[model samples]
Target: MNSSPSVKIVSKCFVKPKTILEESKKPYYLSPWDFAMLSVHYIQKGLLFQKPLHSTDTLLDKLRESLAIALVHFYPLAGRLSAQINENTKSYSVFVDCSNSPGAGFIYATSEAVNHDGRTMSLLTVQVTELVDGIFIGLSINHAMGDGTSFWNFFSAWSEIFQAQESNKTDELYLKNPPVLKRYIPQGYGPLFSLPYSHPDEFIRTYESPILKERIFCFSSETIRLLKAKINQVCGTTSISSFQSLTAVIWRCITRARRLPIERETSCRLAADNRGRMYPPLPRDYFGNCLSALRTAAKAGVLLENDLGWAALKVHQAVADHTSEKVTIMIDQWLKSPFIYHIDRLFEPMSVMMGSSPRFDKYGCEFGMGKALTLRSGYAHKFDGKVSAYPGREGGGSIDLEVCLVPQFMEALESDEEFMSLVYF
Candidate 1:
């Protein structure tokens, strides 16, 4: 395992929106989907790029300027979170205060580290760390503000604005697919609800994360296609997708590595997006939290004894089962009895949870430093069983799996024959 790199903060300042809205004080109400994420950790992600020829002065100025302009369209990101409690109802409401706000935090730091720990309370925080041979731009976006789709949309838009600076098209540039500002609240559920919490932070608990070693494993496109085909043949079903096959492989490998009890309950939690699943489906570009965790479980003995096809079929079933009815039912239930998912909820025994997705345009964020050398995640919402998936930097439908687990489990996985055979590096 590599040693954890230390970081030193050079500068930190809040970057307000470059342009104010016509209705400055309008509050963006929290949707049922958005409110459900109040207690979760931030989505921490970063990009690695080789050193740009531009000087630090020029680079910093460009980043600050572009981010401010990006916030002009993503104005809600520039505001602060406002929470108010109703004593009689014993509930609270939280929303983005778009009044005179301090905006996102722009951080300048120097470090050998590329991943930033998502410890800030700010809605939108970015760290631009200057490395010895590259620049690491890490972002800590609040999950309440958006999901994976919205997060990448902000990145793509920001990058586009930055890339257009040389062509002098900044003034006329507009968001090709601007975010839909309307919040999603389930039918008959409400425009406002008294949450079951006294404060947002109270529900968003704080606890020390366990020591875990993380490694990146890459699988090629050809290998994935072959594996998917094999699984489908064995299962006698052509519906299993490449994603299901890959996820099944990893889940099985990790279960073996953990060396759990034979009768132990084992499960995989998949963050399934609701945009396409909703009836009259949401705009592909609709912003805000529209995702739910699809959890599927089995006995350890059953899982280990089953073939890869069986496991893949289970995954496929989970996706197929996540219909629009399920999404609405989920929201309806949350409104009835609201609850927060703490970090420990993700690190259960013999469990694996998937975060992010291979579908995101991870390598599309190019800010003149050429294409990203690779995509990396930060230290938030990460645990022994958490897995993040990204498209390979080389493209070609390849996939990269970022696996985090206990040190011993990691060592066992590295030695697993079937697991390592498909790993490209």
Candidate 2:
């Protein structure tokens, strides 16, 4: 697995819409939050399969064919982003022009990437690696297109259609359950052009930050159990969840590694999904971004001095604050002041953003193949203080954290005795 695998491009093409799907050429407004992601390129998601195919053409054709079918329903992914201004308000907003463009980019690659540790090692970096018996598929979608939930909704649908095609069944049911594209925003919500901007051109300019070291840390079920038990013991309570416990430990370790002043405020920004928390719950198939970030902060001294339970309590409380009433109030706040959404964080110093959910069964995404051997974020995400978690391939309530941090802090974190004791590479 350590050897550098060779990857060769076999074909490059666009998986255009299956039919001349007609719609109003009107643009879908990018929510205030969606504007923040404009400068960011598509988020890369990947899947590894071990199914033996008769030929590379067989796999590529199946993928392109199923993608065309999937895009028929999730057409926005097939479109491009453009900035539009409201003449009367003299303000601007971003929108997706869903008119038939050349569909999503499709690449077929052949590689010799190795598989180990229950999954393919660094397969995402390899475009197409051919082993004796398997192939890997990589997918990219603009972040403005949707958040993880929406992205996965499309992924699940695509997987369903692929499976149906294999079984000679029609995927009309999937097409019928199309994503709801009407953005649910409070009336009179204006363009988010007024948000604080450290860099005024950020929306136009791509985010380019200093190089970051990416590492994958795996926490076993047994390690998590011990950590949770220790946190519960510290608080004399057993209510703290595994996520809160892990976040608490990682945040503390990261802070200590930076060697920041103990008096400085250190905060963890966690995204709370609002799909089911709204007054009228959004459809399970609701597409696009519906995330609200909650910042839990404490003096570095408090975090460093206290046990993990203290940090867990703060995380728990921050999450608890997102009740239906709070969600409604939040919508009102964003409508009244769109600038409150923080896009400036992209250019600012490192602050953690956690994504992916163990609740989502990534391991179960079948595509005619038996099952995915491994699933991961496609790129070595270089954003400062970005952390994404996925259910471990080992499948015993374990978690794998993809951490992107500055090299110094990464070295410090890797060497930290307490942190390393609970983590495996």
Candidate 3:
């Protein structure tokens, strides 16, 4: 780790805002699945710091304070989720812990580290191995919170504040009081957000014992681009984005590998940032959860029948409903739901769920060491599988992906030649 003087700087900024929403006072409810996801990230904590610094405490304190401030405006949801879960089920607390171990102490090592036993919430954690010279900051956040894009917004603001302090500049960035949810009319005639509680008698089955799990193969950027181009050619349209293409491919692979029936519709959830797409980019640096879920239908044969291009187009149209107004309305409705009703379960019948966003870049997380080697989701205990992709370096015209899936399904995909060709192209 390279030591730098900027690491010594620390700010005394603090905010104590009062909670306004009733949900703010409630505890977070973690269903049996939620608890499983949170447990997977328990041991994967730590961020690396390579910048030359005088003391680790100073840097950590500054980073924590910066994150806290960035998160202040979005306070109501901050402690609310955890509070709600604890009220109904057994509660667990997420704390920030730091250590300076050799080799594995850096964020680079910890960020990609996964718990084979699937007992932790986040697969990656900030290590901050060497603070005196080189600085590494490992960030590990639960997937339930906003996606990578949202995380980067909060991270960039932290970096900006840190840079200002290092140069002896006064802090000009301050969060406004009572963060408001930009209001908008929702699409469709149904409620903004609702969960189906009545399970069919046939849906009941004997409980299957939990099994140990591991994240499958690491995807490269080159193959992702090929898949996108191929999808475009087949679909005969360019309106679809690379994200849509890759998601379709993954959804297809998972369904086929799992032997899911074609007629059986799978519900896949994609994460969307209701920012610039909204009336105005909701405070570029506004922290807290500024995300909404866009649900898409996952038909098993969709990818096999069409090329990558066609899949991409289909995905784009399927998810078009997730607009800024739709997201705001969804959040409002979720907050208003009864404590006994677990809202996330509404998508359970869909068989699978997927989420992705471009927020990872905004982290501005360069601590002088270098850009983070990898970024991925914390863990998915509820859904059957989850995939998160970020833009790659060098404008590779491809996106880097981090995927979480059932171990058996991942193994079968890895051994299949066709899937490998599409993934690595």
Candidate 4:
């Protein structure tokens, strides 16, 4: 692993919206998915090109300038979250006060190391580092603002602006698709963020954990191909995809490494994107939390004792079950009790929160200089079982994973022969 340079904080401030909104655009309600993330920050790190820039001041100025422009389109991100209480029910719902009340937070820092990989992330909290030659931009957006898709949409927009300015094409810098801000609720369904039960404090009571060890593991295209073929051969089916194959293998391997009680139920919670899973589909640039979680669970003994293909089938089935009807039903269910996710189990040993999608182009994020050296979360997502998967930077049908686990289980995972054979440090 490459060592990251020492980073020193230069400044930290909020980047407010450059343009003001009309009185009609002051407040926006968070969707049920967005409301669920009220207590947390969605932190992401991006590494700029390695070549040295003119100066730190120059780089920071450009960043702040582009951010201000980006905020014009994503103005709600510059707003603060507030709640309104219902005296009759004694419950409150959260909404984004988009009256330019506050701005997105920004930090400037320098690192001694050349590259900041997953190895350098803090187990305690979200952190960002920069190098003399390159800068690492860390974003800490409130989770209630959007999901991964929304995060990237805003980021890509920023990059587009930066790219245009860097190339002196500011006049041509226009958003192809502006964010769709229309809030959607199922017919006959009441408000999703009903209070008391959906209170931010109440949700935080679930899944809060102590520090956990996080590491990134890369799997090449050939290894993934072989795993998929082997699973197909065993199961006599060709329908399984590379993602299902890899996810199945990793899940089983982690279970074996944990060495949990054989009969205990172990669950894999997959964060399913419902962008096109709706009846008519959402806008391509729909800016909100539109995620549906699909879960697959089995006894530890059953998962580990079967052939790899058997576990892969479970994953395939779990994904296949998420039809359009189920997605609407999920929304209906959420409207009934939006705040309760039973996420208390997520902090337990037997559960995993699988996020980040291979379908999204993580490596294509360009801030005018070049593609990012790497993209990662600022903090660990799960204590014992969290997995974030992305397409490999190598770009030949490969995969990469950011895994967080308990210390002992991580040690076991490090030494597991079958798991390590396909993994690169």
Candidate 5:
């Protein structure tokens, strides 16, 4: 790693947007945490090595050229959003900050051994606090734009552009016509409708709670596959995939640890990306959020009443239901409703959690040197969180997981033999 002095410059292009101010109704209501999340890159920093010598200006020019291509689809990076709410209306502004920084304020270095994986993963590290390095880059869109899958597709496109690769393959997957946002008047009048109880401020305050994360030791892919096969053998069902089996086992383990009454009920929130699943499959390159949540509930009685095989079957069915068109439509409706207006409030009281699978592998984020040795989100939010398994640096089928949970739960899980067996085995 090389060190360099910070550079600060002012450019008219970086100014804030008027839309943001109008929508927030407050000139300065932007959340620092949100802004930081939006701005952070997946690969915080990178090491690059080349033949002779290249001027810093040349590198900067190359970076700018690539960014312009990337910004064509990801317009959000080009500007910041502001909101304004008053008696007559709620408006937002999108201001562009034209100011320049002392350039990419950070040190630059290269090593002969540092391998360049091509342009897609060759982005240099973004300079942020060391603590924030491991977290995922969160973008807070209007929720009106699209879903998580759409966002992933966009990132893939941007990656292709950065690599100077053809985007035709990705373009074919997205909708030919861009999505149009539908406008609706809130049934209730006044600023009350605009003010979500769980405001952006609260989100920033409790974003890093310990209860939101938990650590599970890595497991070998072979072991996971074996476990899946064993589960299938016991259940006599070939339809269930390894991911479904693992999810079932995880759910059961968490339930046992919590020791809720056998009759009590609990739910796990699962996110599904609707890219390839859509009729005219969404563009694999469309950038924006295209994620939807599916809730799976288990009554303590139902779990305890059945053997592991039966429980796994139940979990499988629940997950299947989530992928149904009906479920997708329902989720779409909810996201666009008034209830979503207070989403921040709902997240706080809810025991919502996530279990991402397979998708982690696709984040193949490389910025010249090579794919990231590790990829993780910056901080644990209010909800309990976990990423799906990914290949470890060692090159075996080992699984790498990042989890956030309450401190107490974490302590218990760390020492619990049963939990360890499930996680490690």
Candidate 6:
């Protein structure tokens, strides 16, 4: 590893939105979809780029100014959550206070060579660090505010505006797909529906988070193509998708690496997008947490015993079964049950969850930087079995799987020849 210089923070400031929210939208209501994520932690992600020719001051100013303008469309980022307990139900209700208060956090830090909370803070925080040879932008957004799609869409649009200003073409800059802020509230549900948790703290799921380690395994176009092809060929069917095939390979390898008991159940969960699965269907860019966590499981021994194609086929079935009808049913059920997604409710021992997606425009946010070098993540939803996917920086059919696991399991996975041989990097 190269020895890098440390970064020192030169400045910190709050960049409010260029515009304000209308009074009608003041207590911006939170939909069932958004409320479900109240127990989740903030989403932490970073984008890295090679240092640009512009001075740090210029770069920081443009980013901040562009961010302020972008917040006009994503004004929720400028607000904080206002929660209240429902007297009768003994549950808490939360909504975004879209008032002009603490906006997004902006930090400017530059390394000599070089080189970073949650609740009651700004809903969004952005930190741009100038490295010895690059820049790293760190983001922490409340989970209830949005999901990965919303997260990247706002970032992409912000960068789009920045690039326009950098080239002095701000007049022509426009967001092709502006964020759709309308929450997806189920029918008959009032804006004041309270969650099952009496207090906001009741929604939080706590556990002894073990020391964890992570590795980003790269899968090239050819490798993924061959893997998909080979798996289907083995299964004697062509229904397996690139995603299913790749996820299967990972699930199987991780199970083997963990050395879990044969009888134990190992689960594979995928965050399925609900935009296409909604009743009337939502926009491709509809903001907020419009996603469902789909899971499938098998005994560790059974998963290891099966061929890669067998594992892929199992995952494909789960994906195929989540139709619009089922999605509607699940939402309706939530209305009756009204449970929040606490950690215990979603994660478990020996389970792997596929999050983010290869479809995200990971490199589309130029911001006048030549090219993004790589993406990094902060410690947020970093459970041992969490796996976040992103399109490869090179952007072919390539993909990057950011795998987080307990330290010991990560060590075993790195040395597992079967897994390493299949990955491009």
Write the residue-wise lDDT of candidate 3 on 1-425 in tens digits. Answer: 12244543232222222223444343323221122222122222123344543566676655555444444443322332211124233432222111111101113233322222122323223334443445545444443333345445545554665565555552555522233423222334222222222321212122221342435343456676566667777777666676777777776666666766666666556666665556545665433344555666656665455554555565687667666666556545544451221224444543445545443552345543355544433333324465555555434454655555567876776766666765532
- Number of the top candidate by TM-score? 1
Q: For each candidate, what TM-score against the reference?
A: 0.94, 0.82, 0.59, 0.87, 0.61, 0.93
Which portions of model 2 miss their true places by more than 4 Å?
A: 1-9, 20-29, 86-89, 108-134, 171-178, 187-202, 340-350, 379-381
C-alpha lDDT of residue 363 in model 5: 45
Q: In model 2, where is the ten-residue run with the lowest total lDDT?
A: 114-123
Across 1-425, the per-residue lDDT of candidate 4 in tens digits comes to 11234445557666766767684266676676665554443445454465435665776687788888888788777766566666677676666666635466665532212011111221011123456566566554455566778777777788788777787886667886678876665666445466564334555543355667889899999988988899999999999999889888789989988898998999877888888888999887898888876889899999988988998899999999999999878777767665544445434566766787776766666765577777666542455688988888888888889898888888999999989998865
- The CA root-mean-square deviation of candidate 2, after full C-alpha superposition on the true structure, stands at 6.6
lDDT of 5 by residue, 1-425 (tens): 22224422212122122123232222212111112222222221221223114444444444444445544444443332333334343322112222211112122221111101111122122321122222122222222233434333444444455455333343233333332212121224222123222333321222223435446456667766787788899989887776666666666666665666876776655566655555445565444434455566768668756776776776678667755475346534543442322223433332334544444433454333244445433331334434344445444445655555566655665666755775653
The CA lDDT at 198 in model 4 is 30
Error (Å) of candidate 4 at residue 239 is 1.8
Candidate 5 wrongly placed segments (more than 4 Å): 1-65, 82-86, 89-213, 276-281, 331-336, 341-352, 360-363, 380-382, 385-398, 422-425
For each candidate, how many residue pairs have backbone atoms clashing (under 3 Å)?
0, 3, 68, 5, 87, 3
Overall lDDT per candidate, in order of appearance: 0.81, 0.67, 0.44, 0.69, 0.41, 0.80
- Compared with the true structure, what per-residue lDDT tens digits does model 2 show for residues 285-385? 78877877777888888888987788888887888777999878866665555542223443335456676676666776677777788875654235767
For model 4, the stretches where C-alpha displacement exceeds 4 angstroms are 1-8, 48-51, 109-128, 188-193, 197-208, 340-343, 346-348
Candidate 1 lDDT by residue in tens digits, 1-425: 11144666778888888888775468777787777676666677889999999897788899899998898888888877776687777788777777756778887532222111122245888888888999988777887888898999899889888888757888998878887878887677667756776655556666455899989999999888899999999999899988889999999999999888998999997888899998979998888888888888898889999999889989999999999899878877888887656667645766899888999988999988999998887766767888999998878788999999989999999999999999996
Cα TM-score of candidate 1: 0.94
Q: Ten residues in a row with the worst lDDT in model 3?
A: 97-106
Q: Residue pairs in steric clash, candidate 6?
A: 5-114, 7-115, 113-132
Which candidate, 2 or 4, has the higher TM-score? Answer: 4
Q: Worst ten-residue run, lDDT, model 5?
A: 111-120
**Error at 128, model 2, angstroms:** 5.6
**lDDT-best of 5 and 6:** 6
